[model samples]
Target: MAEGVGRGEILLRPLPCRAPPPDGAPVTGTLRLLLGDQLTRSITALDGLDPANDVVVMAEVQAEASYVRHHKQKIAFLFSAMRHFAAALEAEGVRVDYVRHDAPGNPGSLDGVVAAAVARHGPAHLVMTEPGEWRVRQMMEEWRETLPVPVHIRPDTRFVASHDDFADWARGRRQFRMEFFYREMRRKTGLLMADDAPAGGQWNFDAENRKRLPEGERLPDRRRFPPDAVTREVIALVERSFPDHFGTLEGFGWGVTREDALAALDDFIAYGLPRFGDYQDAMKAGADFLFHGLISPYLNAGLLTPLEVCRRAEAAWAEGHAPLNAVEGFIRQIIGWREFVRGLYWHEMPDYAATNHFDAHRPLPAFYWTGETDMACLAAVVDVTRRTAYAHHIQRLMVTGNFALLAGIAPREIEEWYLAVYADAYEWVELPNVHGM
Candidate 1:
């Protein structure tokens, strides 16, 4: 374990730190807030600010971890990401009031944290990026109605399609299919179509993307970003605080900064995109990554946007750097299924979580947590998930989700695992994919 930090301790293992603002410069206003999957950049709150008078507040709340028995890497990922982001804000000359999970006198829940921050800081107003989960949104609504200061919730701009846009698309529809919505998005965005026609002759190359690897086939080594000091600190904290949780820190390699995330994206574009379309859905023994883009963490954290990623993939296609199938397949992931799932979540949620359409009731097998299953495919996928807190879409849907479906594991139980393990999981994107798709 890394030295010094522990659960809930406000240990500032600086990624890149800023010298404190000129000593004794009179403190003025502060804004209490929350940052989970949607709320990333400080600009979501900072852009409307009088920085000379406003300080931005963010916290690593214990309620998040305790709400579900989260996978260890998932807990480590969020806490580390938040710490890195907080450091970035401080570097930009923004005053940040950060509450660490293990800090003394810290509140375990967002409600308590925000209330305490407001009581002490007394800002003129509270601003936040609207949360993606119904429960969090409800809490925020309650706080807005009752809190001392006026709370301002801003719409997230990370996605290409808005909540209203998705609702409008679903109007008068009886059955919702992602392909139809994706075609509309393609036309609206001019992604892979030329004059409203698919760039080649096909709208989807999924037929070509599903071929599995032949036995004993060697996969090119998956690229990984080395953990920075901040991530190391967070890993130490997880080791000390969550010894019983699933997952290990031995091979903890994740990007902690925006620059590292960008690098990871470029690496995928160069090394993986050519084969991404061909094996995008393939599963095999010991092969965890099959040419999948690993930028979900950055995208989920607001470090990157769907538009920017799509634009880059499109640009790669335009330049002949990658083939149409590969580029289109990757683009579809972001603009296609990603948006569709979010819409389905918002459309059916609160109820969606309870819709055990198949009514699966068996407990999730013990090996899901231990990755000790006898099935080769499942063991490989779960092992990778336990170590990295990540698995590409196919691994998630077909392998793990398929096993859960076969074993009759409760949808709620399976949903909890998906939500708890992946860095990209937010209720809006995670729920519909797990429960319905």
Candidate 2:
């Protein structure tokens, strides 16, 4: 029964294998699990990848996609980006077990996928970088007792700030504001400050960034990364699968590959950075993107690290090509407020989601789906969101989210819409920003 017919001959074995005894089974190999957001090359789990023994398991689980009625483009972005990453790993001769959404007996969630992969591979240990969402982390921990392998969740190396470091800075603080944290970050990273002090004797140049669109000030032509074959396929699949979902795919111009994301970052540095600070908080009626860096999609999807972005802004500052406020405001967003909000999210999650300060429980307006709002600003942002699946911070915070907050839209409902629409609206960042900011 064990003998093969010939060299290179195909062999079919019985499907069922006897389950080994729970306590006596030996741990044989290592399994590294990567969630969708952990798509960057700088992750720690890939440091010691051995093509012969190690298996990298990445899955497109239904739990993630169905958590909210995700936008057609958002789903396409994550799945398409993940597939691209998997292909890159395979090109590097790295062994990868990618679980597609349509695979038979597919796990409905990440937990189920991890269990199946561990059982199939019979690995000794499970390695992964820490997940951003608390719920995901809890499920992952629960899998440790259920799975036969020891799970080791390592700190994500993508962020410049550490949990312990951020906690220490926040210790004994009264009100946890992003401004104070931004200053500390400026000192720690030496990003846009002179001798641990904010440049130009001001911590924030937000006043400079709040200029509304002048009556005749016309915006230059916006930049975009045209869709490639993979993205086009993804758009078609999304249109077919999620016909009822909001958002248009006709103008779906996003960077699907890492190289494209880098090009986008460079373009923003050269063109967008000069006016980014000036218009960071401004909103215009028909302008989709007004002097804003459209790099959030890259930053949120793990294609670009926050540290690298801050460094780029710093380089611009050193060259005196951009003003202190512009460079500083942009850098603080990457290094300061982003991390501060993330820390707050982790510290108060599962409870924070339930907070309704204004007791808003209204359904998201129907206009959010169709971009049919009376206000010209909402119309513009929503139209852009529908077409491109991308919106700058002002559009998100002031135009869309601000309207939701002012109109007393339910936090949960608003969160769902934001999560569904924007390519960069992941739970970790979107939740707090929607809830409080």
In model 2, the worst 10-residue window by lDDT is: 1-10
Q: Write the per-residue lDDT of candidate 1 for residues 1-437, one digit (tens) a residue.
A: 00000222433222222223355553235473647453356436555555556666677777777577677776777777777776776777766678876788777778887787677666666777777788887888899778887777877666667788899999999989899999888988888878979888878887777776667655667668677787888888888987887777888777766777788888888878877887787876666676788898778777777877888888888998888888988999989999888777777767777887777799988888877767887888887887788898888888888888888998888888787777677677777887766
lDDT by residue (209-327, candidate 2, tens digit) is: 77666778756565667777767766776677667776777766677778878888888888888878877787766677877778887787788888888888889878987877889
Query: C-alpha displacement of 298 in model 1, angstroms?
Result: 1.7
Candidate 2 whole-model C-alpha lDDT, 0 to 1: 0.75
Error of 1 at 261 (Å): 0.6
Off by over 4 Å in 2: 1-28, 215-218
For candidate 2, the per-residue lDDT at 5 reads: 6
Error of 2 at 19 (Å): 17
> What does the lDDT read for residue 189 in candidate 1?
87
